[model samples]
Target chain A: MALSIAGAGRNALTEKAAWFSESLARGLKVARAFDRDQPKMRISEVAAKTGMTRASARRYLLTLKSLGYVGSENEWFYPLPRILELGYAFVSSARLEEFVEPILQRLSEATDAAAHFAVFDNNETLCLGSVFSQKLFGFFISIGARQPAYAGSMGKVLLAGLSDTKLEEYLASVRRVAHTKETVTSAAILRREITEVREQGYALNRGEMTPGIVGVAVPVRNKDGTVASVVNANWISTSSIKAAEIKRCLGPLREAAKQIEMRLASGAVPTGWVSRER
Target chain B: MALSIAGAGRNALTEKAAWFSESLARGLKVARAFDRDQPKMRISEVAAKTGMTRASARRYLLTLKSLGYVGSENEWFYPLPRILELGYAFVSSARLEEFVEPILQRLSEATDAAAHFAVFDNNETLCLGSVFSQKLFGFFISIGARQPAYAGSMGKVLLAGLSDTKLEEYLASVRRVAHTKETVTSAAILRREITEVREQGYALNRGEMTPGIVGVAVPVRNKDGTVASVVNANWISTSSIKAAEIKRCLGPLREAAKQIEMRLASGAVPTGWVSRER
Candidate 1:
């Protein structure tokens, strides 16, 4: 089906799309080559990762540079801050704050932990908004950060929100690699866990995605009662604060999620309502 | 020269040029149509703003959407969060933060006010980052927001850092619109203010940009002693916290800026330092 669509697009753009045709694939690859770990790249580095010629990579880099999306200093190329404007534009305008951010903030303050609001994109989860606790030693995940959907507390909650058929298809496709010793790598185990998550109306992860990190997540439903996103609070566990304490934190987390759902239902979810359409 | 360049660009593309001429312009226009204020737009809105047909806008939107740079929901479109990956890719990786964010954060804390770090971009000033004090009543400006270089404390500080010739040219080109009652509008007054700001090692705004707000700013110097950006702290003046209090806050603000400068000299800036690059 994907091949047929590509073939049809090719036929449709034969004469007019030639300029973009060659660079489109290379551009997408170039964008993917940039990540939190490897943000800046040399022409050679980009070429190696994207499997493009150095010359092609250079062209794309220069093009991006001219567009003010990339910066070059002393021969090393890096993505520039203007790129954040794109994300900020969406998130800031999306009125998510009216519904989501305050709830996340209150949850973080209540639990004294980092709280995150995340949505599913394909098989991965993207953190849309986040609030950091005042505590010095809490989970500090940057906004716009991504993680696999099968692993963490918020990821599992979002995954559970999917239809059973879609969830099964996703499980079949994923490798379910263990992130920590306690991570559920088996598809059957994950399926059962997601079922429980759905039944209990929340999900929990203890040292699953990251060591010493414990979290509980609940889905934020939309006006139609469909799950829109997952809100999670993460904290570092010591002997003083065990899994049970973390579970106790879930009550405020769920309350905050419910509040956000009510805000969304009231149509107060900010002007840039991209999540609703997605 | 500009007209000649435009004419040359209008000429036929080289055989190496891959995309259709109109498609390239349409794509660029679609990308440009999004700004800090209007980050998301419907297809008809984009068409209206870019002066392109809805079909052309849809084509560009689909192309960008496929690349993961643009996103859409229920026919409403927005730039995506990954767009920040580009800007942050450069800033997070750059040494700019060694002398920027820390100073701003410390200044904010010391003053119990809001501190901003901004850099010059052409004729405007772009906010690199800001740190707000724990106090509830502080200025709320995001990291990527832009302001006219001729107005505001940070803007004037950055303007003072420019070369004399460039400063003269920019001053000639700018439209000195008054933002508040105390805004400096006359060229002679502004020139004198800039000169004083240069000599005093800081700039002060007494309710110039926004009424009831007072700001003090100092330039952050790079390793080569060139002014890289400006750091400013903002506070509200009432009977309790007068202008004297605001001026007193500059002491710690300057010390913080100096510490950041030392960090920049030591080249100890963190990896993945994304902030406003341009």
Candidate 2:
């Protein structure tokens, strides 16, 4: 059956494009609007966040609930674990374990630190995969965890990968939170840090986001030489011992990133799974 | 801005519902249709698998591409990393780490085995969280990994949690593949095994799914007294040493399950994150 959205009044991108489904786009927005800060939200909360009418948000939430992707109790609505099927669909389809998992595991083992591989998502860096070394503090890396662009080594490396225009746009749009006393919330300072990350081909953070954890990250590049993902190894250290730890982890982190880059360049990863845009 | 589907035919459940967005439902189906086996699919393939016409599939895929959730290479369409946001939204909203992560970590450390917490999803058991002990085998449990209901201790415990009628229907419908010679593929045998699991309050498997691994699992129950999730600990063992390992792990698995059950019952976890259905 043919579907039409003649006057749905969506964004110009979908409005101008033929065969676009505004309903689908809006539904996904509603699904994503419920995050850690607002796990269970009302229709009005969703509408306010997603810029959809309350009626539109209600329809999408109810539809998702019926599909088992969402659940509701009284006026509160929240996502179900079944919603993970969507992410797993990508993780499984990408078969990231075959390439990224082993590398992270090996890196973690070698450096005695937690290792992670992450990609840029929205304005944050999202961990697509991670391996917890457990040798340091009980710092368990949660998959799908996010860190702001100005806070972590991996985040700065990811921000460095963006084009100047995009990076500027991101810095202008993002609200920089002071996660720790060391967090750089100034856009000008973050821009300088990202610039240094680009030149050095690595980024280092000394408890900027989370205290006592020092991280060293290097970018994994695609065949086109653009950053596809960032691989990092982090350790728990005192201020006095931080420099030696960073120095110790940097070589292995860079080596692992190069291995991952070579794998991507060798055409082992699916084309669709690689970072195609900033 | 009222939209009506007066003539568009869908399943009776959705057809009878008010304020249900069919476009949204169909769009999610198209997204989930790309899994490990069919990472990248042609329009015709997606159409046939999702039971939509080629034109409809094309529209959904294109719309998803525009939204950065799906990517296309020539005639093939595949999901993007952005799709993980949908799953992460649920994961972040659920905040499962507060109860499940530390418990799994402790269980793994105590048993010296890899530990995982999984829930029933469709016909398979989906691992929602896990911890690697790095002691027994280098067997890393990937989150979002799925196992057949008849194959693993965790899967069997989940299957046993089903009502008799639902269990019967599931056994009838599932394609039971023999992952190993020891795997029970016979429906009658599986039914008997599930019955024993229901009686025993736990399940054990000796190399059924992976020939070298022995696993024991116990169900974590919801406030309603139904199984919410299954906690498992597994070790690499030969057939000769399997029974001892299973016995060793069973106690900790049960204890961990109890802790998780208490956490769930105490309303410590968000209500929307709990298993409201089998």
lDDT of each: 0.69, 0.82
- Give one digit per residue, the lDDT tens place, for model 1 in B1-278: 99886777656355325432334335656755776466678989999998988787777877777656677778778776555444445445543343355556557767777778776764677776665455534355555666787778888888787788777887788888999888888888988999999998888878777777877888888866677777888877642335577578778878877876776577555322222222
State the iRMSD of every prediction, in order shown: 4.8, 1.6
DockQ for every model comes to 0.29, 0.64
CAPRI rating of model 1:
acceptable
lDDT tens digits, residue span A16-105, model 2: 467889899999999999887999999999999999999999899988988988888899998888888888888888787766877887
Return the DockQ of model 2: 0.64
- Identify the candidate with maximal TM-score: 2
TM-score versus the correct structure, for each prediction: 0.81, 0.90
lDDT of 1 by residue, A73-151 (tens): 7777776655555455544555444345566767876887778888776577777666555552435554556788887
